[model samples]
Target: MLRAMRYLDYAATTPVLPEVTDAMVAVLTGDFGNPSSVHAYGRAAREIVEDARDRVASAVGASPAEIVFTAGGTEADNLAIKGATRKLRGNGNHVITTAFEHHAVLDTVEWLGHDEFETTVLPVGPDGLVDPAAVAAAVRPSTILVSIMAVNNEIGTAQPLAEIARAVKGANPSTLVHTDAVQMLGNLPVNVHELGLDFAAFSAHKFGGPKGVGFLFARSHAPVEALLHGGGHEGGLRSGTLNVPGLAGLGVAAEIAAKEVDHKIERVGGLRTRLWQGIEDSIERVRLNGHPTERVPGTLNVSFEGADGETLLLLFDAAGIACSAGSACQSGAIDPSHVLLAIGVPREIAKGSVRFSLGRESTDEDVDAVLEVLPGIVESARRVG
Candidate 1:
């Protein structure tokens, strides 16, 4: 009902909640201060940041001392991969990750490869689940870090992190296990210790908080070197002046998400299933992407044969239904999705896929509207293609 279009791209970024916005506004106007300064204002700002860190940590079963705030998920991913690799330079120049990782992890590993480091990209099965055995087999004697995302952003596929972490640690006790948990934070239970991960990344905007705020969870024993060099902030692991207002919003959002995730999951999961069932009942020559049941409850990705994703997206837009061709960052590209291809989808169908992500705010009426609009859009796109 917004601008006559129904939004279905919550995975890309969520709208900030009114409570989170109010918290941020209070900080921006009333408690504005540089955390590094030596004054009452500075102390107040520092206290806010610290309390926010504690809330975020509690949400993920981490300690406040282990959380290092960053600009966003991408920066957190870069810091964890690059910083951990740099710290273990003497141990080896080898790292291991999955083929289906987001570009942040994939690109960082590619950059490391350019620097003479050997990287092994493990393959996922057609189910889009990485096998723990594959990771254990890929680990070389020189392997120093194993990084994997807790959930796939494109398809909402959940990786077996607990199994993967145990395998990595068993193969090489010194090797660090890092997971990008940005998409999994609000949708799933993310206990770092329970998952046996050394480091993990999260972003606020993914969970109805303000953007440009994220955190990296680093275990005490698996400390990474500072990626940014200045100001000695975040225990010298990430150095820069803190975003006080954004941090406050993040804290409020995290607490709200933690308290409401279970109920939200049930509601959104039902909506996602209704959408998927509607599509399946109406459409033909369509394939669902990712694992059948082992995915985030709020996301559904589907590939329609003989259709162009970009064309279908436009058709749906014209009909007042908002969806995505693929990842927001890669929307302009014409090539097939690497994530879809990794899961063994045909290139042509991959080119015709769209991701529909639901959120806590989605209603049954919104779900029905999409069901009414999408089949015709897909039919039209296929005929045109």
Candidate 2:
């Protein structure tokens, strides 16, 4: 029997590839040991954790000593933002970031602000890109950290990280620059050194690995305090017992992703362009969000005027086409995406936006299926409502 539908929500999460699953399963069934114990079994598990760290670090142009694993992207972001901000509290209390950042970063900064730190959320341009000059202007003498995302989850806009890092460092070399690279890790080329960032966050599931594992890359010189207090683990920055199976899966996924990134980019970019072209040719009253050329290769966000995003999503779901209204983390909420609002999209249009994110498993047939079904769904939604 033929499958009824297709999934295009790679931005939310990806299914674990067979190889990644096998790697994790081996650890789960064969060498199940608590990495914190002093026994030989624990040592075996700890070795797997360390090996995964090296793979993840090498994929991002960092050393194994710099990688710290966490539960996932949210924990990694919280630890990087809250830990760095609190550690630098003695030096300063102000922080700067973009308004278009994922809620993980935005909410974390807001919570930090409530805790007595000052925060400046810089506005993005119409293209959803932040100006380095604006970032520099927002930095106060008391600013201790600058947190920006490598890619906007809603619109797939890629930030000028290298430039922003340079601007922040030039303004105050002591002001650490951190980027949420969770969405960018598999879709784009990421080198922490080339970006000039002091710290960065990444999640394994975003790149075909297990869901429970992620890592933060903190430069050797960057000062950061631990978010969790427990048995000394992850160099005291994160203290929970390591997830051995998840770590093994992450290691295999990282190595595979690093080797295939260039080819994936080329293939996914072509698929995205094809999908966009079909939408442009068939759909009316549609608008594309984010910088057309500066966005991620496999993400296409568009708004259909006068259509409700949630309704369209349901219709698409019935048709077996899977996508998202915005960031999956924030999808259940009623409010429109803050990212679209930051880019100056009207509230009504923003409420109608849909994000189609491609992945390695997507194909021309999948794109064609969506192109065939989406226009009718939009038209039907417009007519009924």
Candidate 3:
């Protein structure tokens, strides 16, 4: 007999909610048409895409016209940084970001350095939180843009976005602010104006929607240049034929997430607390990573001394538990997580880290299940070490 499978990697990706998948079937089966065509079939498809745009925009507290749909979070990030920075290059070469940002932002900033633009990677304190004062101090009159993530993917630390935005504007009003909010959109309340962000990127799959569909929120006042050039779709910013079925699914998911966010947060947060307690009660030489109180409720990263994270993850997999050693993006990479290193976690501890992320469907039993076997898993790994 098989042990019950437990999924603890919601942050990496979530299975599509049943309602969202059901909603997509209509578009997939019959309503499919090219959104750009001028015919009646196309017009109908256009409406579905538009409705999806509205739902997604409402979730983020932005207007639909400001939403530029892209392939996924990475594409959206590329568009926001490269497109926005392209227009600002004449003003200054400097752009500011944190050391713990996802590679989408980190690699993009570094690529800019290869050209005319310069990059400044700010440091985070031991709490895995960025200091607003550091942002204010780093702002140069030449600084044209600042891109920070609303949440760290690996460590799950929530940044002081509002505080940091104020620092950026207070230091240099000309600088535009952007955030990689893919991890934050459905999990937290996101308002572009309220959050003081000029640009934001999100992935649909991160919020129980289908993958390969995401959007960019570019404030009307802070326009981004077109990353792709062709049919001038998406207000001429991100030109591509719309994915009607994917949009429909994404819209439904966003609507559900927005309507049920508070309740889900409370539920998942409670389960996460239990999971943390379970591990602490059973495991020794383990330390929690990330901000203790200022993190998203669904995610917890922990380090086990004297054990290999890779081995622990493999053991967990064999025990019918799904978890992560670090960011899903870094899967198959042997190096310790950059987020852990930036937060001053020693290399040895970082090497043994594992991340557990809960979701709306997660239950108390799942927490208990992991708790039941984790001690053995850790002990087995340590003995082999």
Candidate 4:
């Protein structure tokens, strides 16, 4: 028999839950009408879409009307950053974000900066945390928006969104706050109102739902412009035929997550701790790459002093272990991780880092498998490097 693959890359994407799959199959077979068409069949399809909207909103503590479905987390980030800035540009041309963000946000802001916007890319501390006070200090009267990610996909560090939002608003009440929260939904409870956020982005696939469907939480009063214009679907923000089956899957996943996230967090946290402890006790010179206590429970980033990260990944793959050198988006790039470099990791150390992210289905056996195999893999990779 083939060896079972020990998967540890949930931060890249998660397997769709069985319930989500069943929900999607049901919609695929039964609700195949265009939701915008005015017929009984269309009405039934519209109900499925709207009910999913409500379920997604409830999971994130937002109103159903505020959730604008999009293609995925990248589109949600693009819409939130670009759409919001376009709408608010009349107020100011200045925008602020961090040094290390997903390219969806970083690239969007970079493109805007090339045009008419004055952009501020703030530096993160060595511990992978952004200081709220620095955000307040960066806020100018002409600053229109501030975008930050709730959790770093590479390091699993959770930013203090509430504090950052409060700081931004205190400095300029008109400056809007947005977060690329694609990594937050499955790891923590996200409440847009409680966090004082004007916008937030999420992807269903990151949390056990189907891929290619996600939503943007645009607060009721937030000013946002249409990125895709056509028949004016999604309140005219994103116009396209709805992915009914994907939305149905997303709804079920959200509902299940709302009930089980706490338990998942606890269980995954324990597994991550064991994995880290095992590596620490067994390996000679591995460094943990994020804030010890201020990160999500499911992720652990480590750097082995003398091994190349790419080589480590290859050996791990050959050994039937799945993991990543950094964000899946930057999978094959030659450079070290921007997040690690931003947090003051030495270039050599950064080049040797890898990430292990657990999920709801991860268990003690997975941890045991990693511990049993990792030391030899590291040794082999070090000699090869």
Q: What TM-score against the true fold does each predicted structure earn?
A: 0.98, 0.98, 0.98, 0.98
The segments of candidate 3 whose C-alpha lies over 4 angstroms from its true place after superposition are 1-4
Off by over 4 Å in 1: none
Residue 319, candidate 3: alpha-carbon lDDT: 87
Per-residue lDDT of 29-121 in model 2, one digit per residue for the tens? 998999887899999888898889889998999988889999888899999899988888888899888888888899999998899999898
Output the worst ten-in-a-row residue range by lDDT, candidate 1: 1-10
Clashing pairs in 2: none
lDDT of 3 by residue, 275-350 (tens): 8988888888999999888989899999999998999999999988999998999987857999999999999889
Model 4 score (lDDT): 0.93
True-structure lDDT of candidate 1: 0.90
Tens-digit lDDT string for candidate 1 (53-143) = 9999999999988999999999999999999889889889999988889899999999999988999998899989999988988888899
Q: How high is the lDDT of residue 7 in model 1?
A: 83
Q: Rate the local accuracy (lDDT) of all candidates.
A: 0.90, 0.90, 0.90, 0.93
How many clashing pairs in candidate 3?
A: 0
lDDT of 4 at 206: 92
Better of 1 and 4 by lDDT: 4
